[model samples]
Target: MARSSRSSAPEPTQGRFRRILGKTITYGLILALLVALGVAVAVAAAVRNLPSFEELRRSPTAQTIRLRDVNGTVIVSIGPNYGRWLKVSETPAVMRDAMVAVEDRRFRYHFGVDPIGLARSVKVAFERRGTGRRLQGASTISQQLARNVFLSNNYSMARKAREAILAMALEWKFSKDEILELYLNKVYFGGGSYGVDAASRTFFGHGAEELSLSEAAIIAGLVKAPSRYSPTADAQAAVGRANVVLDVMVDAGVITPAQRASAAPAEVRLASEPNQNSARYFTDWAIPQLDALIDESVEPLDVWTTLDLDMQRTATASIQSNTPEGAQAALVALDRDGAVRAMVGGRDYVSSNYNRATKAERQPGSAWKLFVYMAALESGYKVDDEVVDEPVTINGWTPRNSNGRFSGTIDLRTAFAYSVNTVAAKLGDSIGYSTVANMARRFGITSELNTQPSMVLGTADVRVIDLTAAFAAVSAGGKSIQPYGITKVSTAEGRTLYERAPPPQNILVDAWVAAGITDLLQTAVNTGTGRAAQIGRPVAGKTGTTSSNKDGWFLGFSSGLTTGVWMGRDDARPVTGLQGGAAPARAFADFMRVAVANRPVEEFTTQVELPQWQLESDEEAYYGDPSLEAQFVDENGQPIELDPAQPGPQPRDTPGDGPGPDTADKPRLDRRWIDEVTGSGGDNGNRATGQRGSGQGGP
Candidate 1:
């Protein structure tokens, strides 16, 4: 009975131990299941808040607008938001290797996130949490791309979890090369540059495929902190970063130790600074037109413009060197077809954005004489016809020559060459002011013209561009011109958005009229007021100085090109000693000297024949008229006969009371010519004309 009792007690103790062990195992399993469930819930929640992978894949990237010169050299870039897009095939292997070495050394072996790197980051975070130091991120290339494209850069557990989930999704959807390509294009480099392509061009002045090992390393180092690592900003730090990348590349067996060493000390030749070209005036002028050419739905464009950068430099230098103190200058050059080649809007575009070439409306002064003379030629008036330069008055306003001394009875050609004020005024009054205004309009003068007689003297304001275009008509043999700059616009993918075709030729002036005027202007440039503007070529130009010397103008053209230069104070105050024949003419000459150096010299076409009337004397043509006493007038406002027998000034016949001269015997003038001479040809010899100076006279 005692053996039975001891055995039964041992069995009870054994049963209790077994039961306690079983309960302990059960509770442990329950706790493990709960923790696993909680982790799954957190991960699921993070995934739900992340952007959809398909949406991110389909999103459009911002683009840049590149403007190129006529020679296809990039002058400036407009929008640099996402920079230029480059495919994976376009990226050089060395550049890609450098990026991987610096950014994610284990990028090839890692799934999406580097678990070993994350572990180290976690340990470091805990150590530095209380030390006021920033915690390092453990993002692989895929993780970085996921965050950059589909998630914010917010540092939080939730954001980190979302990044991991999106990274894994990207790994599942794309190849390693695809992920790397997207990461490179989406990454931001400093200086308003994004993507490997843009960054390569911005730093090396070359494409990504042309990047040297040293350049690749430097560019790769910039990924960590673009502005901070930018060589332009901090060369020493950027080089240090590049050396670290080179060592990593060596460690990864991507490059030899010798290559790393060679690359580490290589000098980084960064690209030249942008906006160094003097094309801002043209770019600013073209901005509005560029915008109009592109549609909103189209991607960013590449515009090819008609700017000759070399000529632009020449134009800018000429204007800057010749502009006088306290004065501003503007210039515009156009090809024969009216392509704006070079334009300098002011002395310095930085100091002032006011484009004088296209904007300013100042009096053209005697440059306006081109239209008046054109009117006379069209009116059957000969350039060599006699016109008295003596002082004249009409309705109490007297006109005087620039020298303040009249050279009586000068030919129209000599009068125009010297900018003789009295002759031009009398011609305007005789032909009527309306005739001169109409001629100006016919020649592309868009400015409003005052009907007063002074309008012929260029008292009316006009734009420099319009005046330049009008001169282009004579250079182009009477064809009207509209100045244009852009030639073509296309997307980066080579899709044509706009292309300019040759504009139709529109004739604005008669060929004979243009030829006649071109001849007279050539004489002016060769032997007259515009003599300073001669470029050792057959150039035709006119010189003008406004009242008080407020504005000086030189409008000239060659057979190949036309250019206009204007010098004046912006405030319209007079510039002392400034004349169109001086600085303005010299500026024109300097610019043309460089512009035409490479072009073949050509002479002006002489297409017009001299009129028979111009070849004969007035005495032989009208000597035998019965009413010669009523037909001709002298300087004293008295009728005179062709014969000396009736030379004494005779009283005028009563109005319409006598038989007029036989029409056949009289050398009949066109009614327009008759009215012109009969109304204003007679001179008032005793009138006092106004003060005048060199090159300061009527057109």
Candidate 2:
């Protein structure tokens, strides 16, 4: 065929081949250069945003709130725990080699990224592409450190470029040991632990410097998947993973086969689980109180609390042993100055974080009688004052004793000993509910109270801590106290940041009243309902059982320690055969039996003398004049209002206008009832002993 003028004659085959080859080489080189330029620009952009090498080398450690007991023993750490930063030289050689062997054998030679490993991974992925196998990541230790410290795991080309650039920068500015040290201290291990030292301490119950070969291997294996390989989560899987790490160590020539064979599964012993729940409830309660003491925002604190670790252990054991199955119990014990010595908020803190002692507000039941008797005593009523404990109804609400019967015309001390609800109700009706509530407030009862007659029978909901603190006041010889836990707060370097000052010693009740109430509580524990709490020593306490057996409580003091215990279901469901004297009282006894063993025995004392007593006719004594409405007056005998600083429900606009028990059917008082109610009385028991540090007048 003839060639057209526009087309040249058929070119030589050799010429055509050479022309194609030249064009191919030229175009390929141009594309390659363009790609290289783009990569260089991306690298430059990433490297420019990175922080200085000095800043990167610091390896910031996460701070956490650490709590210590009175003995300075660690109670708990509230956040991710980071031990002291460990240098590469400080880390055991076995641990270092294991990490390098399993994570990146080429770590010693690679500048930052391992191209040969990446190529190998890519080849393997391509070979298994149709087999549903995923692409393996060839990121070296440096790349991991870069991503973890300065970048995010975004899985984008830009992020990879930044990570690679940052890794290179780390290598360029720091030595190989410094880079490894930063990585070792910055990587997160399992179980809320950060850094290699923390991991070693957590897993091996020792420091990173003390790690053995097997333990080191196990810890190194956790870097890939912490939760999956955590020894605490799966010991067998972790040991298997550690065996794989040993194999890699052997292949990398970091360890000989004979050495690997010696590191058996049995040699990989994990540390026993820590006492995390030992006092978790107490720490939870003490955490919020930090905001008031220090600038927690500036740095973490090491709170030196008032918790007696031994007593706390005993209290937890007592509650766990005595509390009925399917029910929960809370206990709070305080020193004379209101320092919380030991506290257990529930049966199991993990199963339920609800702090029953500090948070739950349930009826105090007969334990409410502490305020009733205290108010009556402060109002001039004696422990020996005669009161009728009969089937009495006021405002249509009849306060029945737990025994369903009464002692009928019993002394106040006797009735209190047996926890007579009828006598408490009559006192509430005669003294006025507001007076009782104010008395509770004076003693630091900071719960909302119902000022009705039933409230006198312990019908108001109150926190265990508040009620315990109130009783602590009586135990402190009428000196009111604010319950506290944290004694001092300091920084990690032992710099005192905040220390608790001595709480104000505000007198809540009269010494005579305190002595009188002590007499009543002594009677209750010695020969009455609280008998179960008797530790064969001088113990005085009260027992309370709510309606339908919904709640049970025992509060008392002995040898300068006051404690309160409450037992019931969280749902407020009735527990059959449950009563304050049975479970709570026994728990108190079991706890006190050990808690106060070292404390010296102190006999209770009184300064006031009781007047001559006589029983009156049922007509005149049982039914007081209906015209006389109950009144509460201050020291001047004038009417008073509720103190706003105290935590309690304000009285109704009409003080005695609530749905209280009818007065007509209640006790009949003498003409001098108001004036005579304030008469002081003597304690029937030993009344000449000294109080704590007084050598006279024991509470």
Model 2 residue 434 lDDT score = 96
Tell me the alpha-carbon RMSD of every candidate. Answer: 21.8, 18.0
Residue pairs with colliding backbones in model 1 are none
How well does model 2 score by local distance difference test? 0.78
Please write out the lDDT profile of model 1 over residues 1-699, one tens digit for every residue.
999887788887889999999998998898998976875565566556644544544554444678888999987887654545667788888888989987888888887889988898889989878886655758999988876665555567787777777776666667788788788887767666767888888878877778888888888989888756787655777888888888889998899988877774348777665444458778767856865665432277788998988999999999999988999999999999989999988887655546789889999989989999888887877655678878788767787767677777666767777788888888888888999999889878888887887788899999998999999988888898889989999988899989999889888777777877886788778767888898988899999899888999999898589999999998899997568989999999999999998899898864455454543446546654334322444333333344446743344342322355433233323332343333332321111122222342333
Top candidate when judged by lDDT against the true structure: 2
TM-score of each: 0.55, 0.55
* C-alpha lDDT of all candidate models, in order: 0.77, 0.78
Range of the 10 consecutive residues with the lowest summed lDDT in candidate 2 = 690-699
| lDDT, candidate 2, 607-640, per-residue tens | 4443322122222233443332444433233344
lDDT of 1: 0.77
